[model samples]
Target: MSRGAGTAVGVLLILTGLVWAGQGLGLIGGSFMTGQTRWLVIGLAVASVGAALLAFVRRRGG
Candidate 1:
C-alpha cells in the first residue's frame, strides 16, 4: 500500500484500539450488544473494517 494508505490503516488501528479499551472500561456503548456481547460485536465490526480497508487500499505509487 502507499504510505498514505498505510497511515490510514494506522489511524484505523488507533481508533479500533481506543474503541476496545473504552468497551473494556464501559465508557462507551457497543451499539447492538450489552456486556460481553458488546466486546464481541464491536471487535468483529472493527476487524471487518480493517480487513476491508486493507483489501481495497491502493497498493502502488507511494
Candidate 2:
C-alpha cells in the first residue's frame, strides 16, 4: 500500500485498539468487552500490528 494509506490505517488501528484495550481493562465501560481478558489480548494484538505498520512506513522514509 501507499505510504499515506499505510499511515492512515496504522493510526486508525492504533486508536481503535486503544479504545478496545480500555474497554477490556474496564477503563472505558458500557460494552460487553468491558473487563474481558480476550478483548484485552485482541486489542494489544491490533495495536501491535498498527505499531508495526507505522514502523514500516517510517522505515520506508514516508
Q: Which one is best on lDDT?
A: 2
lDDT of 2 by residue, 16-53 (tens): 99999999999999999999988999999999999999
Per-residue lDDT of candidate 1, residues 1-62 (tens digit): 67676758956865785577466456677543334555756666676677656655545335
Per-residue lDDT value at 28 in model 1: 70
Question: Which candidate's TM-score is highest?
Answer: 2
Residue pairs with clashing backbones, model 2: none
- What is the C-alpha local distance difference test score of candidate 2? 0.94
Q: At residue 53, what lDDT does model 1 achieve? A: 64
